[model samples]
Target: MTLRLAFMGTPDFAARSLAEIAAAGHEVVHVFTQPPRRRGRGQSEQKTPVHQLAEVLGIPVSTPASFRDPDVIAHFASLDLDLAAVVAYGQILPQAALYAPRMGCLNLHASLLPRWRGAAPIQRAIMAGDTMTGVQLQQMEAGLDTGPILLSETVRIKDSDTAASLHDRLMEAGALMWPRALAALERGSLEAVSQSSDGVTYARKISSDEARIDWSRSAEELSNHVRGLSPFPGAWFEMPGEKRPVRVKVLLAEPVSGEAAAGPGTVIEGLTVACGEGALRLVRLQREGKGAMDAATFLNGNSLPAGTVLD
Candidate 1:
């Protein structure tokens, strides 16, 4: 029997799951996404990735400011959905909406349960230097990602993995796992385990304030920060000259053993800087408003002479 599903999501990550669900032969009754918001240089209202995809698939889309409206509730109830699959929906589901689905609501979260339980899990996991992170399908229970887990798959965090790269991998893995989970649901054989109180951590949203690179920290710490924030709101540092700091976004970096007595933020070599304990070689970087370039390109255009101080 084709499960009647109400798909709810807003971002690229969520769109992948919705595509997978449709390809799996489920009947998606409707899609609920956040309203279009102004974006880009023109500041024009733009639909989210999920919204675009829903339209392409000819599925009805709903963008409500809030779920408290009786009219919205009535419309949602009218769908008569069997289940709702939510991925990065960016809104709180009320109790009435939760119960509207016969099988309840299932969310595709980006991190392992009982750890990194809130927004920005991918960035948080890399920033904390965690060894492992994964995706979980959990039964929503009003609380913030505290629900029981329906299915999960673990992925190892590589030493050089960045948030963007890890996010792509997890999205693919989540799509692969969703079908099996849904099959179990259909067979009435799915099991959910309550999350443990231990290892609980909230992945607060990334802030621009935290993007500034503090060279005072150890090499390992700075390297983690760089990789964690890589590719978005990138970790940056101030360079000498120019009234404002020269924002350099680190795209790639690796820890290296060095005994430079230079202070933190001091440029010891062409592409290496001394940290609190060790040194790191900047592999790839980008100047503000410029495309990412190799170390040699960055040096040729904006050389950091030896002994130049950075922050």
Candidate 2:
């Protein structure tokens, strides 16, 4: 039986789940997305990934700023949805909207619930050097990610995984899991379990201030920092330039042992910088006004000789 579904989400990660849920033969009657915002170099207004897909699927879409509006809540209730699935929707649903659907709301969160309960879970996990993380489908409630679990799938955090890579992995997991859970819901066999209270930790948002790389840290820590923030709000250090200091983002890096002979932040070898305890070699870097490049290509264009210090 095709359940009357409504999907709420913003990012492409959510977009994939919405696609799969629809493909599973659910009647995705409507979609709720955040409004289009200016993005990219041109700053052109762009619709959210979910909204774009909903349009492609010929489903009606709504971009409500908030559910505080009584009309917004009533409009959702009018849909008479069997269930509403949320994935990185970026906004918290109030109780009025939470129970608007006949079966209430379900969320696919990136991290294991109660562990990384707040925003930026994927980034925080990598930055904290966590070895495992996964997608959790939970019952939506008034509190933050405090919901009970309906289903979950775990994946190992690889040494080379960045937030971008982990995000894609979790999205795929959600795409598969959402349909499975929906199938169970269709049969009334799905069960909800309370999340364990022992390991609660919040994954706060990544700040712009946290982007600057600190060379005084150990190479291993610096490596995690780099990978954690890679591809967005990247971990950066300032390079000495002829005119002034230049900011460069380290998109990929690995810790190397006993390599640097200089003080922390000093270049001891080609793209290898000294840290407090070890050395980190820059793998991929991006300079302002230029595209991302390998350490070799970046070195070929500019010079960072031995004994030069980066801040």
Candidate 3:
């Protein structure tokens, strides 16, 4: 039997779970998403991914600015929802809203829990050189991702994984958990397990300045840092040019064992820069205002010969 549910989410990551819920034959009573905001180069008002999907699905959508309003909380409670499924919903649900559903709110958090608990778990996990990370289905509480885990699926962090690659992988992994969780919930078989107090780490939001490449760090650490912020707010470094310093983003790289007389940010050979400890072979790069290209393709048009110093 299907449960009467309300879905709350934002962004593409959250949209996947919403689709799965509808596909699972649950009666989605409503959808709550963040309000539209101006974004992009033109700064035009754009609806969130969840908001757009709910429209196409023919489900009623609510874009409440805040759940703090008495009317907002009352409206949600009025849904008479058996349960509410939340994923990557930006806002914090108030205590009243948390208990509005019959079974309270169940969230799909993109982390193993108690570890990497905060705004940017996916990025932070890769940045911190973590060898593992996963998505957990948590029972929502008033605290920030402090809820007990009802279910979890682990995904390995490959050396080649960037935030973008790992994000898609985790999303696919998370989609499978939703059906299993909801079905178990309907069967009265789901269980919640509290997170361990140890190994707790906060994944604070990524800042603009933090994305700048620091060449002085070890090659291995620098590779992780570049992968963590890749493809968006990309890890960038400046290259010395005749006219001015040209900014280049390292989209992909690998830490290699080697030694060079040159210091960090110097091109030792073939797009490989000597780090404070080893060397990094930049596999992919993008110059400002140019499309991303492999190091070979980038070298064909531009020049970053050996002995060249990068800022």
Candidate 4:
């Protein structure tokens, strides 16, 4: 009972699900992804990971700038797809295209639906210090992620969990759950539960403005912020008394119990910084355009003596 599916996705997160769908013996009739855009230092065009993978698998790839065009809509309708699965697909699917598939569209969302239901859900959940989050398979509607849930699996958020780590775990979870969901769909046993209106939260996309570290917050809060943005658009602060306000990105840190009277943003012991509530011991950090290094390694090369406040 292999279902005919049209796969739509772009990034690594989406690619994993696409691979899982193909492995499950489904006929992936077409793949709709955003057109290649200029990227990197050379500003050369780079095809999306899903686009390249779909090409390798010999599946038809479509990169329509807009589905409003009648010709593009005609091509989509020509596929006569049973279902379409979308995961982190950058573009918005039009209402006309939504009904093109027989069984409608299903989305593999990264967060527990009705909570963190927009872009950057994984990072938002971590940054908000949520204790638990999960992946959900939903019936895609016109509204932004406001759809009925078809399947979900919860995962605990550890104190040490970072965005990168949680993202990997969720991807694996999605891969495992998607096949079961599809099997249920084939048997006409898939249940769709309406999402609760309460507990709804939007995960706005991360911005460069939000990356600047504000030392006035609690150590735990700051630690979560640092971890959530780690390995990309890192949480950073400028060193005081430096000629050019050198930015130091905090890659890893741990909260420690301390009652020092040091002011906020003040570097207490060269490695630890006093927060409004507690202190955090920085483990790994990096300078602008430099590779990440351990706290000791960073100190050896670039000295930040004790009491040298950060801004």
TM-scores for every candidate against the unseen true structure? 0.96, 0.97, 0.95, 0.96
Task: Name the regions of candidate 2 deviating beyond 4 angstroms.
Answer: none
Error of 4 at 181 (Å): 1.2
For residues 1-311, could you state the per-residue lDDT of candidate 4 as single tens digits? 89998998999888889998898999999999989999988999999999999998999999989877889888988998999999998888888888889999999998998999899999899889999999999999899999899999999988888889999999999878889999999999999999999999999989988988888899999999999998777889987534788888998998878775798877788689988889888999998878899999999888787787888
Q: Candidate 3: which stretches are off by over 4 Å? A: none
lDDT of 3 by residue, 1-311 (tens): 89999999999999999988899999998999999999978999999999999999999999999988999999999999999999988988999999989999999988899999999998999999999999999999989999999999999999889999999999988978999999999889998899999999999988877888888899999999989988887899999877999999888999988775789889988899988989899999999989999999999988878999888
Model 2: number of clashes? 0
RMSD (Å) per prediction: 1.4, 1.2, 1.6, 1.4
Better of 2 and 4 by lDDT: 2
RMSD of 2: 1.2
Model 2: how far residue 182 lies from native, Å: 0.7
Instruction: List runs of model 1 lying over 4 Å from the truth.
Output: none
Lowest lDDT 10-residue stretch of candidate 1: 238-247
Residues 127-201 of candidate 1 have per-residue lDDT tens digits of 899999999999999899999999999999999799889999999999888788888999999999999999999
Q: Summarize candidate 2's per-residue lDDT along 212-306 as a digit string, tens digits.
A: 89898999999999988989989998998889999999999999987467899999889999998899999999998899999999999989999
What shift in Å separates residue 254 of candidate 1 from its native position after superposition?
Answer: 1.2
